[model samples]
Target chain A: MRTDLLRRVEDRLRSLLAAERDLWSGVHEGAVVPIDALAELIASGGKRIRPAFCVTGYLAAGGDPDDPGIVSAGAALEMLHLSALVHDDVLDDSGTRRGVPTVHTKYTQLHGSRGWQGESRRYGEGVALLVGDLALVYSGELMAEAPRSVVPEWNRLRSEVMIGQYMDVHAAAEFSVDPRTSRLIARIKSGRYTIHRPLVVGASAAGRGDLAPAFEEYGEAVGEAFQLRDDLLDAFGDSADTGKPTGLDFTQHKMTPLLGWAMQRDEHIQALITEPGHTPDEVRRRLLETGVPDDVERHIGGLVERGCKAIADAPVDEVWRTELADMARRVAYRTS
Target chain B: MRTDLLRRVEDRLRSLLAAERDLWSGVHEGAVVPIDALAELIASGGKRIRPAFCVTGYLAAGGDPDDPGIVSAGAALEMLHLSALVHDDVLDDSGTRRGVPTVHTKYTQLHGSRGWQGESRRYGEGVALLVGDLALVYSGELMAEAPRSVVPEWNRLRSEVMIGQYMDVHAAAEFSVDPRTSRLIARIKSGRYTIHRPLVVGASAAGRGDLAPAFEEYGEAVGEAFQLRDDLLDAFGDSADTGKPTGLDFTQHKMTPLLGWAMQRDEHIQALITEPGHTPDEVRRRLLETGVPDDVERHIGGLVERGCKAIADAPVDEVWRTELADMARRVAYRTS
Candidate 1:
């Protein structure tokens, strides 16, 4: 059921975009550019984690496969994430995403090479901004196809993520290190947006909102684990595997919960992050020396355990419960 | 009726932001920053053109005021316009909006002055990007409160505007002057999004989809006139009344329908816009010498007449018909 739903979501995304491309291509040749950007990003692919959780939650709650709302809902989640990625890449000046030149990077070069009218950076970033807006609008269009019950959660989820992202940017700029702030960012951006809300949105789609409490608990724990692992991957993971540059968090001086925890223990980490001319490798080697990586690893394990335990007695089908546990482990331990 | 509805829309917008601010401030002090930006923009107002058109559309269609959905739809249109304005300011690099420093300008200074960790430009632009995103999300939230029947038109209106803006940006970059492309962009961005779709959404909220045809015709004609006046305002109007720097279109090399028409008759205007070191005064003087501004004034009068005539025989109440005619004149001929 999960695999089928995932396929359906994938199909919906491709065909919807293809249809948009077809329609806009006739309007003006340039109208298709942003739609094409969206299509390329989708094809380049990420983990599809949000959609997976959404569909899995729907199936685990025994939703009817024929309802069709879940498919659109899942697709909407992925599209929303795409918008965030496009805009976030601009914020981070991330040059590449999913192994492809990011929208801004590609367009910036296009403008620079062509000697376009305005500032090349502005033109490129502006194209990317509009493309992201298109994606956000498209996400809403898809979500409108879902059941009305999803509205409240969907609204809350989107606003929470944006606000959390604002705070994340603010924290990074300030080079802040507060566990309370970091935890709040993680809870809103990762715990809820990525994991908890998707699960509840799915279950609610299936008319089983009673599972929200358990889903929320499990989602928060496992989502934090997911985010910690993300920070680890950003710090030390292979660029080849991740398809994005490593140690961007360090370079951007992002106060990741992982980094915040490390900063609490090692004074030098702050200097390494905030001070220029210090390489990511310097920060990575320093991070290793701080012994905080091991602590993070241990915390991730505990969070995964707590997450699994949260759903242990839930009334989900036993098979699905076991699958959820496996999903937790995969999310926590996956390298990329 | 329109006045009361507009007031309700204004109240809805203020209370909604206040509530969001209250909720986010509890999470983190900095989290309320974006919400505050939105509130400030809304407070330092423009004409509230979109909301006025929306509520006017609903009232003209003989929709009942107590229904409440029209108010939210009106507010949604305004919120969506705010999102566009925020992003458009970034795209245009306009330092000021509504006679105050723009979000990017203000944040960029903060980042520069405080010596933020990342590039100040990136940090400032990023904050503005996220704040714009928050407005987009909030627009969706408000639209959700409206009747579901408004969704299709709402969706179409948003995608049209974004894509139209994309094409506009591309046209400016390419410095293209095709009349067809300019008119198409104008129709999509202004005719539909600014006037027609909001009205349709309003009427649809009241279950008056039947009024769409008249609204469409009136909107397209008046919207074009409205856009030409916008170009004129940018080229020649006072910033004190408009609350924004004039001649941004000239500097950005925007291929407005007004410019496209003028260029067809005059050969030298293109160089005036495309080349650097030419002041807005030069462009304005050159534009006047081309005798195009006079043609534009004549064209705007004709379009406004066309707009009012299109709805003259519609089923709308006689009083409302006169009000809408007055709105078209106000939109097309106002100093700002």
Candidate 2:
């Protein structure tokens, strides 16, 4: 029954995106080509995980399965998430996303083909940026037009997630970031946006605001566990399974959970990392040689075990526990 | 009275931005450096035209000056405009904005000083993007949290402005863009955002919805005039006064009104423009030599003269006519 509900939500989200894309039909003659290309690329490759969580959480809280309002709101969250990803790729100079050429890359290719000097990169970044802005605008419109009961929570979720994104970016750039600061960044950047806020939005839409706190706690634990698990995968998983380049964190200079843990390791491993210009591949290999992968994998194992225990221990309805268990089975245990 | 009202709006805007800036405190090692830097850069530079329009339109519609709700809504619009500008500069690869180094450039310089190659640009773009997102989020939050009476109109204005931005970006890229398409883009991108919607919000706040249509029409005409005048300045204005390198449009290949008009000029001018490898300066000089400048200047002169006549002929209120008159004086007779 829960699977059926998630499927329906996915369908609704696809429909909403399709409707919005149609609005760009009359965009200026030269601009429509790239805009349409980017939008289609985004729509084609989305995992729609955020929207699905929003919908499932709503349903788990007894939301009406047929509620068009809830569906539209959930879709808006998905679109916003997609917008964030599109802009992020441009900022990161990422060439590929979700096993496809990124919007910027595609647009850049067109620009190059047209023989317009320096235009390829400009077109890519410009169009992607505009599309992201469009997503944000539409997200608000969807929330505002939602059934009145759901508007308050939807707006709150949107604002909080944006604030959290700001905190995440700000925190990442600091050198001597404290543990508490890091944790706060973690909570706002990944914990709240990925789980807590989505859960609350869903619950509120379902008129189950009373369950919000419990869901928040559940989301926190699960979210932390998810990040930890992802950190482990970054080091240990096969390239195909992760669909990401191996040693990506080391290359990008990203300080993930595994790296943070390794930074706290006994002196030898720490010295190798502190070495300037050390390739991410070299760091990953060194960590592997030091038997650090096993240690980190054990840590991830512990986080998942603990996260599940906490979800199980929560004083919530059996329905929520069951749904969470299912989620853990799908998310924490899966290879992909 | 109008000047006093503008002062009130400006003060309110500063306070709101300050409060919003405070929200980032302690999130980044007890120093909100990046967010503060970006926000300060944005806050200090903008003209606050949107907020002025909101305030004046409200007053024209008999709005109460002391209503905190209108003030908040007006401030929110200004922030939204700021957010758009920050992102737009990044998108445009503009090095300086309002006579200051752009956020991306500042970050790049800082990164270079720190010997952080390439990372600084990424860091700057990432932080600036997040900052823009934050402003956008807060803009909605401000309106959403406004007293319920003005909420609907605020929502409408936000939607219109955002949709208009999308349309504007789309229109700017098109090749076969007709005059009507150009006019529509001007209306949505500049007219509605800069004037019409602000007026609607003001009128709605003042319980004078009847004035919205006139405001919309007036805004459309004036906004087109504004964009057309901008094109003229780009083509012919002094570099010192405009703060842009003269002939930048030809270099950037921007489809401006001057170039658009020149495209339809006699065969002599068309031949010069199609010359291969001509430097932007050479192109500008050649076009001017072909008497394109006289034609463009005459065209602009005609626009200003006709624009004033149209505004005078319209049945708008006295305040609106006075505002249009001021704009005409600025556009028609200003040396700058």
Candidate 3:
């Protein structure tokens, strides 16, 4: 059933992207570059975790799995995710994503190869920015066709992610390692949008707005677990598995909860992070010796336990409750 | 009456921004930085031409001027403009806007003063990008509160502007100075959103969707005139008067209609634009010698005349016809 729903989401996304490409192609020959970039980015696959969560929420709330609205809304969630990823690549100066050149990198190469007249970097960044904005606009356009009750949640999801992104960037700049700030950023940036809002929006679309509070609690737990696991993966996961280099958070000196906890206990680690002279391997070794990743894994386990309990307590069907529990375990323990 | 409506729009904007600020303050102490930056940008003040056009459209379509929906929709348009401005500053590498430091510049200063860890410029640009995304989300949130009939137009307006921005950047990079592309970019990037869509949105909110075709024609003409005047001002208008440095278009070698005309007529002008060695003053002098600004002014006059004629021919109240004509004249002939 999950695979069927994921397949539906993939199909819906492809069709929507095709429509956008067709529209831009009608505008001008060159007008399709950004749209084509977006299509390619979307084609590079993700786990479709958000859409899966959304579909689970919809079905748990008694929505029919066959409803086209569910697929469309799920596709919208993916587009919004793509929008964030495109902008994020530019921010992180990441050369590739999902083992493919990022939108900005692709455009940079295009400019370089064509011997374009402007600074290739600037032109590339500009195109990426516009493409991100276009994807965001398309996300909203898709969600507009979804059930109206979900619109407010959709709007809140968008705003919260952006605000959380600001908080993340701000904290990084300030070199803030406060655990509270780290937790807040994690919850708002990843937790809510990744799990909570998708569940709430999905339930709302199913005409089960009343289920939002329970879903929020469940999602918060699962989402926090998801992020904590991500932090662990960033430190220790295989690049081949994650499709991204490990130790990015450490090298970037991003104040994840794991780092915040480690910093509180180790002055050497704090100096390494604050001074920015240490290599990722050195930091990762010291961090492992300090047992921070172990602590994060323990926290993820606890959160997964809590999430499973929340799902059990939620006013949803037994079958969906089981599925939700399975999803929580996968999210908390996935290698990627 | 126009002044009263404009005042109302301003007040609406202030209160909405205040609400956002208040919301972020509750989220986290540091979360308010981007929101505050946004408030400062909005307070810096634009001419509010888009809002005015929206109000005029509402009044022309027999909508109640006092309807709160009009004010909210106008605020949405303004927020969207702010979104574009923030992103534009990043794309243009502009240090200032409206005589104040741009968001990225201000944030960069903040990063510098605090001796933050990462590169100040990257941090600043990241914050600006997130802030722009937030503003775009807020724009959609506000428009969602507007009358439902205008939603499709609102979506189109957002997508068109972003698509147009891509075209502008692409043309600059590819050194494509085709007049047709320039005009299309002008219409899509500035004209439609600035005048046409606002008018259509206002009218649609008033249950006058049938009038969109006529309003679009009028808006296209006025908007083209407005952009052409902007190009001329970029060459000839005083920095003190325009609140921006002149000759930016020429220095950037952006494919404006004025540049398009000059390039077609003069090899020296084309070389100066395509090659980056010449100074802004040199380009401006050479462009003036070619009489391109005069030709642009003449084009603006023709467009303004056509716009006024469009308004006169439309099936709307005569009072609005007179007011719109006045607007067309003001937009076409303004020095700043």
Best by TM-score: 1
lDDT of 1 by residue, B1-336 (tens): 778889999999999999998987877888899999999999998889999988888878778898778888889999999999999989988899998999999999999999877788888888889989989998998998898989989988998899999999999998877999998988898889888888888888878999999999999999999898999998899999899999889888899987888888887888888877888888888888888899889999999999999999989989989999999999999997
Write down the lDDT that model 2 would get. Answer: 0.62
Candidate 2 lDDT by residue in tens digits, A199-229: 7777777787886776777677666666656
Tens-digit lDDT track of model 3 for A196-302: 99998899999999989888888999999999988888887898888777777865668888888988877688787666567777888888888878888888889
* CA-based DockQ, model 3: 0.76
Off by over 4 Å in 1: none
Residue B266, candidate 1: Cα error in Å is 2.8
Using lDDT as the measure, the top candidate is: 1
Q: Per-residue lDDT tens digits of candidate 1, residues A222-282?
A: 9999999999999989999999999899888788988998888898889988777888888
First chain of candidate 3, TM-score: 0.96
Model 2: per-residue Cα lDDT over B112-185, one tens digit each: 68764336766777666766776777677666644555556665555455455544444344433255655655
In model 3 chain A, where is the ten-residue run with the lowest total lDDT? A270-279
TM-score of each: 0.99, 0.84, 0.97
Give the TM-score (vs. native) of candidate 2: 0.84
Candidate topping DockQ: 1
Each model's fraction of native contacts = 0.93, 0.28, 0.82
Instruction: Determine the backbone clash count of candidate 2.
Output: 1
- What value does DockQ give for candidate 1? 0.88
